[model samples]
Target: MDIATKQPGVLKPKVGSRSQNIMASRVVLTVLMFALGILMILPFLWMISASLKLQIDVFEFPIRWIPENPQWQNYERVWAGRYPFYRFYVNSIIVTVGATSLVLLTASLGGYAFGKLDFPFKETLFLSYLAMMMIPPQVLLIPRFIMFNWMGWLDTLTVLIIPNAVSAFGTFLLRGFYEQIPKDLSEAAIIDGAGHVRIWSRIIMPLTRPAMLALMIISAMWRWNDYLQPLVFLRRVTNYTIPLGLDFFVQENTAQMNLIMAAAVTATIPLLLLFLITQKYFIRGIVLTGIKG
Candidate 1:
């Protein structure tokens, strides 16, 4: 009648029969992943092929998988081509850096304040930010354009850079990250006579590098590839960013599909490089933020 006297017949096997099922599942997943990888790589392969091809080879009856002669000059041509792709690149870099810096500064401050501080109407203020997320960017486009025009910011760099600088999505992401910090840590800092600024500078920001990188990637990607905003804001061709500049190549090289693909491929490399550099932090930040939020 004792618990220790339990019979072996009542005991289940130590190893379950699910090993076969699990192995089968893994095999299926591997196949699925291989297919997905090929799918994702096709466009990039085509782009590179197009970038290297002669204008005629791009539209050859049997699509050329590899260029017989790689026009290494195509890259140089793209740099000096149509709308000054080099200038567009510089402009995109400038705007991307500025926007990313602004997002990091404001979102880190805003997220820290919301997550840690206990001021009046704090929840309400953050709720307002969350509400803004529901409002689609397209809905505010016309009004924002009008306001920027009134500010005499139309066609200016600020017209492109400032509006996207402070992202609600960034703030939302960082606030969740900030909340994950233990209150005891902040209290200890406070007990040491540390002000909010000291605690944020010394503690919060360092602990949230992943979150900051996420915001940087988000802000940079949006700013770099921002087509509609630049298209509408940049009236003059010389001031265009890569996305807006790409349009010129598309139009001018319409008959030369290879050249257009070359331009498209060129426009894409910076973003790919950016992602490659920060891929670890970017992916980790997203997964952690989603779990925490």
Candidate 2:
């Protein structure tokens, strides 16, 4: 009848052995995860390696992980603009900053309107927004290009920023966050003579810093990585974005893989830093948004 000796309804664990086994499993998993993280970073290692290599060493069969002579000048050469690399960096910054700014502002306002206002056709309007989201950017490319031409905006920053200024995804995301705010909060603000704009700026804006940061990371990454848009809109070498910059690197260099990799590594550094900085907020946003609406 004693609990220590009896098997009882459920068998008891051997406390010391079980604890050790769990600790051992955790240690193994920790090591495995560490190894996988290294594997993910391996290509970056090789990229840095190949960037420093000479053109011949790049294609060499037995690849050295590090160049015999670390070519620090490779970074300098990307800015040298023998191939418009610097130009492309400028172009990318302009488009990215512009597009991300527009996306954030427009999405925030649109999301607030949809979430807080009970205007006529509100449901229909949101559905229409959702419908537009379904229509892939590629499908709209031709019409958008023509529209830009009509407005004389092609190859201009306006052409790039205006099209992506409002994102349905952002609207949807922020609207969900907005809904989490009680109706009484906005009502009280209004009763205190706060206009919608005033409320948005003073009240809602301060609360949604994490959400905005999360949105910025998403939008910035997309714009930074987008190639097809830049390829289509920017025809001149001087107007190229980073993706286009890579193309010019190869074309101008005549298969100078070292320089190309060098330029690529240079370009990737910003995005990597971006990811590292906002990674915590980005993941937190994702997890928080999964809660029931």
Candidate 3:
């Protein structure tokens, strides 16, 4: 006779109780996650609501989830204001795109060499790069500023693009992804008369796409939202990026909270869109990197 059939009463109660416990635990976890998700989204909802309100209504006594009268014109004012916000948009796009592209190129090649190819002092070099990450970015500001000033790059878009073109973090993240790839694939490519370039391009790169996508999103976000670097490097008002331009606007129009919110919303939309578009790859990249590393 089967065990269940031989001990029906005992097995049934034990199995039922275990299942009930599991179901209860899952229910509690689900409720907690749902509440946390809502909490995280609340600030974004408030920002959207405030962007449509009148200046005087923004910080009114009690919180207003929705404005009584929406001021849609705030967006137009932000774009057409004396600050030339369009210029900031163009500058930001140029810098963000240029820096992100350069970072990907350098990081991929460096990661491949460090992770796959053999070379002298490779580990030592990579360890040094990792050590650099521990140094606070603030500590590098003076040296970078002086170097850029010497190169006559200050106040130019090149200043923004060149200084941050390569990232240690990008290299480290991509290296982890590359190391996770099986070496046998590279060996097979080599046997087929493929050089390192061909093996990297044809075999390794295609496999590590999720990691690259994550790096792209991360690099783009940092470049786009950078404030201090732009504030220090860019002098001309017309050359300002979105963050610096928004700060200027807030300073000039301190009383116009509605306009400020509109500007903030405009600055945030691109990042939101980027995350939405690559969210799947981004999450996969994070999980894979964490596990592999």
Candidate 4:
């Protein structure tokens, strides 16, 4: 009887040890994540630092984390240069918006049709379209250039906007999201005399906002940083997008390291702002895609 009465508290030390182990593991994970975050952001810090330093100080021994003499004028010079940076910004904005809009419209419709609507050989057609994603864009570059040339679209904004109007990846992404929606909802809408157009517009589209937002962000980033297409298509200085304009700036001012960094920093601001604003939607889209798929 005495032994049994004394044994009630024996397990408490074991429970305390287990809790301590969990807390220790959490602390280790937190430290690792913090270190990784710092590592990832180091390049951005260096870029900003380089943008403020003089040309000669850029690669100085024992790399400078902070510039001794900050050159705020580097930004001014970049903006006020002979090559029009403002025009490049406007061109990027226009192309990014137009292409992103077209992608959203086409991808959503295509996804809806493939995921929900019945059609002849629908699976085959979607599979074929998905296969196109496997083909390298480089292989089609010459053919696309010739076709655009034939259409008299070279050296124009249309060249940038039209070719990227639709994306197979976008269609596939949205289709996966759409397929996760319950069939009962769509059937109920159909019984209520709603057409495919009405059902998609009213029910499907609103529910998949996260996927659409993700696509928008992705398309915008691709169009904004598009160096190769703009380089090949655009001929005139005034028609140059941000990437091409930056290349031209660098070519003209090879020794002006600070100026180049300043231009790069300016070019990066829009994408950073866009990501910061929509990161929630982007993360949600990715998570949902994984879960649904």
Please give the CA lDDT of all the candidate structures: 0.80, 0.79, 0.85, 0.86
Worst 10 residues of 2 by lDDT: 1-10
Q: Residue-wise lDDT of candidate 2 within 92-143, one digit each (tens)?
A: 8898899999999998998889888889999998999889878888998888
**lDDT digits (tens) for residues 100-154 of candidate 4:** 9999999999999988988999979988998998999888888989999999999
How badly does each model clash, as a count of residue pairs? 0, 0, 0, 0
The sequence of per-residue lDDT tens digits that candidate 3 reaches over residues 188-265 is 889999999998898989998878887887788789999989999989999999999989988988888888888888
lDDT (tens digit, per residue) of candidate 1 on 49-140: 88898876776767778789998887777777656688888888888888789888988888888888899998788899999989988888
Q: Root-mean-square deviation of each candidate, in angstroms?
A: 7.0, 5.0, 5.6, 6.1
* Candidate 4 lDDT: 0.86
Model 1 CA deviation exceeding 4 Å by range: 1-32, 289-293
